[model samples]
Target: MKSGEACLHRLVDKWLAPATVLSVRVVRSGRMPAQRARFVYIEAIAPSGSRGMFFFRHQDGCWRVFPPHDARPSLCVDALAA
Candidate 1:
């Protein structure tokens, strides 16, 4: 299995233990313009008939849970240069 899939399985296991995973699907995938990072939105269903969604982001060459923070424009001032 791919590393990302394995990581996802681990995450699901950690969060939803005792609940059998029925299905997993990638709802969306794309690069975040701000961070220029790849991300995947997933939807999972458990045998207990509960559904959950999560966002997995690719960062530092690893798949991690939660999307990266949005980048906001900020002003930078150089007092020495002024």
Candidate 2:
């Protein structure tokens, strides 16, 4: 995985483990109009039936997770190892 994806993987593994991840969906994604940075909006669901959304922006060769513009979650839980 790329460095950005690797960051997300570590985050998910560190905090979201033990819970089965149901899905991860991209809500929005694109590059900055006048910059090299890229942004992505993502949503995730868990087997427990909880769901949330988050935003990520790529900068300095890394991906940083941020709180959504709205009230959705800032941390997205990816698939946890079964």
Best by TM-score: 1
Name the lDDT value of residue 59 in candidate 1. 56
Candidate 1: minimum summed lDDT over ten consecutive residues — where? 53-62
Top-scoring candidate (lDDT)? 1
Candidate 2 on 1-82: residue-level lDDT in tens? 4654637555544444445777666667776565545666555667676544443554444455652233344654564432
For candidate 2, the 10 contiguous residues with the lowest summed lDDT are 67-76
Q: Give the clashing residue pairs of candidate 2, or none.
A: none
Cα lDDT tens digits, model 1, 1-82, are 4655637666756664444677776778788787888877666677667555565556555566677666687777785568
For model 1 the TM-score comes to 0.53
